[model samples]
Target: MARAPWEGDFPDVFVNCKWKSPDAKIICLADHGLYDAAKGQRDMDAALGLLDDIVLEKTVSKLRGLERQYGVKPKLIAPAAQVSESNNALAIGYANWLGHELGWPVDENIFQMKDFSKDKLNGWVRIAHRSTFYGEIDKKTPYVIVDDVITLGGTLADLRSFILGKGGRVIGMSTIASRDGNDVRIRLDTDTQAKLEKSYGSDLAKFCHELLGFDHRGFTDPEADRVLSCSGYVDLRKKIVRGRNEGDASRSKKQAAR
Candidate 1:
């Protein structure tokens, strides 16, 4: 039998921010764009297909590497429903699909919110006061939280703390897409930080820290500014192309060896 992808080398998961911790890793599958209901569903479905086709094997390989390195697999979790029109039903569906593929149990009842905050203008300090969790999350298990898309990364930051507060160990984070999909390894250098400070001022920068769970996991400027453009969505297509090209090259090399 052909070797499974996971049986090979470890998959590298490059991300802009490390929202959870140094050991807490992330693997983004595809970029999701904002669209109308019908179009959004279609886009999400296509993105989800990538999970079964490309992401699953890669995820398994990555997890195997992590288990070898850390000695365990992190339990998977995804955000519950939003109480507003922005309810992430599609995202929840994607998470369920992912859990099924991974043979992982998903706990959706970890949080119950009176209402999700509407003031996304600041993009940093809005959600902290809005959502709250009630149920008991398993304190013993290490978790790998999944999301459909990471825009400003505020939700991931909040989710990380929520898991930690419940005594859960979040060892990995994953998303199907991000707003700035191409800028995965976005490092904020001294000059970039200075420019952002000049633009949004010190107070908002502090708020960014707060939004990021005060973990200093690192964040992209476009995401911090909440100004990521639609262009980032193209990166998903590019990723698909790259994956296919690499696969073909590998097959060719193997056949030549035969």
Candidate 2:
């Protein structure tokens, strides 16, 4: 059998983005599944179709609702267009779709990523190399950053900080999914957090925050332990394999009963 695209050279998951504290203003249509599906299949058209059919209209509704609730009109910000890769292409398509629906001009090329590949660890989000956003981003204007997924949230954090530094305000962030859980709080209990903090020292705890938008409180004990042990990358493949095994076991049990 052919291996899934996610099972390629890099581990399917890794900590890349810095965390931005969870806020209520942001509206995500779906979770990270959209990103995975798009990248796995290497098909931007199908991904955009899913986003358009299942997520786009609803996303617009949510945006209108947010406008009504906050009285703060939001503009869309996305990573610059990179048509070569599947995920970047999806980002571009999403931005264009949302821009067209709302009649809001998208600052599509506001930020240009120096590196093409996303699998790198250290320079995943190079703030220093990022050129100043040439587009007109009115000061204090509320902007919502869009992405396919929010795993570690390092990229979003970097984007938020960059916008803020440039005199723009980031009211919220929207993405297809949250890597660990949809909620933006610490998932770990107090005792577990304390244990991991003591065992791994303060850096790991900081990493938990930098990688995800939440602090150490967001991780469960097992999750924290997994972070510590996965040294090179966040090994979500284990979770996937374990889930498959459980599913197979469940089917076997059911068949036996029959």
Candidate 3:
């Protein structure tokens, strides 16, 4: 399996992940822009100004690799942007860079609200950032799902379900960073957290401290952490497990196919 950059090179995950292709749809889950700790995320418009050619070149290389490994190249379509931003200039830059390099037209119109919730979504679900979006997703050909980070993949699950329901297929999912998660804490999602606690009587705090890196395992970003904490979604640890499990399953299927 193509291990993420942080996996320490145990073994690369070999899958049908096309890093190169002439035509493919690309979509960024969450805000595809970088998370700056200091200046914070510049609006998508500001992101355009920061995007140098070097970044574009490297991005092209990654996309080509994805296409070669999978089957198609992804023209970045849409991205989750900062709500404070005026426009999708950064997103447009990302899409156009991929489009021009890969010879595909980027679909700039494909997007959703800045953020989504379980109550707001219908059909399938995929985790974008730590949030969830439920609606039309990958339903036709293989599409590319991108995100700035893949912490636990809870958001990705929502994306997966939404895609399946829409009849679209995903060639592969890509992200800037996919932080590891905790398994014990994984049994602590909002849906299953209470059930497991009532059944197994596990202590959430002690478990996170012992097993996961921090008491709040789901959040790696300080700002995101604050956001999640404020939302009262105290069970972020399990999303990592669910995310990894889903990733494992997806890669396993690809491995089996190969």
Q: How well does candidate 2 match the true structure in TM-score terms?
A: 0.49
Query: Residue 138 of candidate 3: its Cα lDDT?
Result: 31
Question: Which scores higher on lDDT, 2 or 3?
Answer: 2
Mind giving the per-residue lDDT tens digits that candidate 3 earns over 130-163? 3323334434445555443344444433343345
Question: What lDDT does model 2 reach?
Answer: 0.48
For model 1 the TM-score comes to: 0.51
Off by over 4 Å in 1: 1-60, 82-87, 112-114, 117-131, 182-258
What TM-score, to 2 decimals, does candidate 3 have? 0.41
Instruction: Find the candidate with the highest lDDT and give its number.
Output: 2
What residue runs in model 3 are displaced by over 4 Å at the alpha carbon? 1-45, 53-59, 75-93, 114-140, 176-258
Per-prediction TM-score, please?
A: 0.51, 0.49, 0.41
Q: Sort by lDDT, best first: what order?
A: 2, 1, 3
**Could you give the C-alpha RMSD of every candidate to the true structure, in order shown?**
17.3, 14.7, 15.5
Better of 1 and 3 by TM-score: 1
